[model samples]
Target: MKKYLLSIFTLIIPIITFAQDSTAEKFDAVFKEYTGWFVEGIFAEIPFTDDIQIPWVLFVLVGGALFFTIYFKFINITGFKTAVKVVQGKYEDIEKHGVDKLYGDQTPGGNVFETIKDDGADGEVSHFQALTAALSATVGLGNIAGVAVALSIGGPGATFWMIVAGLLGMASKFAECTLGVKYRDVGEDGTVYGGPMYYLSKGLKEKGAGGVGKVLAAIFAIFVIGGSFGGGNMFQANQAAAQFTKLFGLTGDNAGMYFGIVMAALVAVVIIGGIKRIASVTEKVVPFMAGIYVLAALIILFANFTLIDDAFALIFEGAFSGLGIAGGLIGVMIQGVRRGAFSNEAGVGSAAIAHSAVRTKYPASEGIVALLEPFVDTVVICTMTALVIIITNFGGDSSAISGTFMQYGVEVKEGVEITATAFDTVIPHFSIVLTIAVILFAFSTMISWSYYGMQGWAYLFGKGKITDLIYKILFLFFVVVGASISLGAVIDFSDAMIFAMVVPNIIGVVMLSPLIRKELKKYMNAINKKEDALEDGATDLVDEM
Candidate 1:
């Protein structure tokens, strides 16, 4: 596997050297020109009016979320308590109930091969690790850069819509992740292969939509691989390298390349260990990074406690009135929904990939927990970031495109830099801390995405050691390319690819949602039973006393 990976890396070395050596100006144009069409196609908008054009994919996401929210009778609200308990391992004993189904005959085909018998649980990772792994992927730059971008265009009103989107998005997360586990394929060695690729194909086949499922699965796999390369690998590496260079005053043509190489090596070390390793690393890093960032936001909020109510008022008002922005009400909604989807990643089906790897007999257990992602990511974390930005920008000129005394002091600032500026506003010299957070966010996101992309790669290619090694090397190469190249078009294309996943993912999810509801019912019943048993035991103990 190592030799095969090395041979593949050798093949890409020339391309990397050429890209690295090429004039930055020339390659930027070349990259944009080559990749421009994909971006245009994926983000193509429908003209709702002379001034309003909404991307169709955004509608796809919103529509699925709305449908699921209603169909599940607002599981996002009803399931929240269960989700919290599940993540807390309250029903840990129930994990054993599903070991037979996980390792035994799951489909009509039965066991693909004799797999390892596990005494404790049938999954590769615990529920927390899966949640963190998925969380690490979504709760990165989007929570930082994307929130700032939305606020700049959509104003405070965008924050309100973002929260609404995140709330509705919970149902979508529940549906897809439930299907992820239900359709997952467990190998003889206990390796789990799941996600939209499996559920779209396998679940659809079971539902008599075999041909549709195959095509959607293939398309989803292809797009997921591209997404992994663009958004997951390169975009992350590029941003991290950029942050590192800016913070330390690193300069030179090769600075980003060097940074990318270091990141690639670190990522390679973790990803080579597969999901278990990825989960372990994320379980630690996600909480730490998120906690620090949230803590800072809390401090800022408290510091501006008097302005909190007024900031929310502006958010509500701006959302409806659009604050006289270009697109008005429609525009703010688009920006909020787009950024919300980008941050929390509901309906995209990526979280389902991570959640599918959890140790539980009831797939719905992870599905319930999966709903927390949007709440934590967009509702909690992104909201904190937005509040800080809004609060810092308070009492300043509302008319200026970019207000004076704002972080960048211009009409527009770069992405995550806006958040840094917000932090620095209350706490002087906090940009250094923000920069570290950004790098950690980027690093953690890349590792998780590496796992996501590799799953797609493995699904498309054979799930062999050589295939895995080859994908890892190629993925590492993209990390370097992403850091060094200023490929606006490429990044745009990759962002589109990430959103494009919603199409097939939602389709499969919509079809398989009934199955998910059934699973949810079963899981809930078990939870009730467990609670009843515990209550009875408590009552008996009280009587004896």
Candidate 2:
């Protein structure tokens, strides 16, 4: 741990020294151009029409989501109630088997075992903790900045398709997370290791596709590691540092760099303890940040209750008609789907890593709970942000052409800035509050992604303590780099790496989906039998009364 901390300082000192030597603008320009060149090919778009070019990655994600929805017989809709019950601990007392070995031998002196064990528990955390951890990763910048950017570009109509994509994405989340749990590795010491990596390799090997599984798992691990550095660590730190500087009126050539160092240090404290620590923090932070952000949005919506109907009217109209946006209907739909996938991350298979650690014997139980991620992230929180933006119309021109507005004599840009403007318009000086929310959102997301990327790193490079420590240190360094550098190319490369996971991940999911269906059926049977037994007990008691 000391060595890891030393490594972080070693990386930071040189970066700060270099930033001191060069002007910020010059540094940013070079970084952006270089990064863009490296990642442009991977993130290249496929032209569907003259004006509607969707990234091939988005197509892979959307296609997998749609296929899973049909294959699972719309489990997203029919299993919603079951998901809620599972997360609420309704089935916690269900008898668990095959875990006696997890408990060590104890002398028969009426003494309790001091060592904590799963005791038939297959995972490390509760259902709710697992869901919150996954939600923390997905429900961050995408809900704030991603939504604002989409609405600005696609207009009010884009909201309609975003919701559509989220609904279908629930099925995709269920499929991958179920596999995550089924193929997971449970150490004798109660450590849990699961994700696309394990499922792709282990699960596929069980189906006589060992060769293909090994290749896919390797590719997924590499992409996941890159994504953790770029999208999960750096991009998040960059946005948070930018927002913090803007809110406090901080001015300096290295302001962002300083902020990134501080942020990285804080993140290092949480990540050093591994997933258990990350889950514990996220369980608290996800609900608090999401609740505060949502409550604020609700207050804004309630303040303008009269315009609620009008906002919905515009959303539906713009979605179908394009409402004079650059690309028309097709463009609006593309924006909505693209942004929705980015925000909820249904087909990315990253959530499966988080959900796989859930303390449940039934893998499908976690899968059912996993479906709620997209619903809460996109359908609920993101919708609130879009509504706030649409109702305020950004406090100025509502036109879609420019995608910019004026606020207090300042040019309101896109992303979180635009969302912040919408909040400030409804309640004066609320930008400060929005700024805090963005920071919390970024912090929670960075820590969660660190765990995710570490899991991948461990899988590929041997799960030694040394390897884990090195990866964590490298991750923290990227957090600082993301804040200090204006690497458009760097961020693009990382974003592409994240999207690239969808290709190999979905292939594994598609092949293993039949097994997921079997697990779902087994889980449903247990739930139904329990319900029936409870109903019979209630009837007998009523008769006695």
Best by TM-score: 1
Q: What TM-score do all the candidates reach, one by one? A: 0.91, 0.90
Question: Once superposed on the true structure, which residue ranges of model 2 sit more than 4 Å away at CA?
Answer: 2-7, 19-38, 95-118, 394-413, 538-545
Residue pairs in candidate 2 whose N, alpha carbon or C atoms collide under 3 angstroms: 35-489, 36-489, 157-319
For residues 473-496, write the lDDT of model 1, one tens digit per residue.
888888888887777667778888
Taking the tens digit of each residue's C-alpha lDDT, what string does model 2 give over 423-520?
Answer: 88778888888889889989999998988898899899977779988898899888888887776666778888898899999999999989999999
Candidate 2 global lDDT: 0.83
Lowest summed lDDT over 10 consecutive residues: which window, candidate 1?
536-545
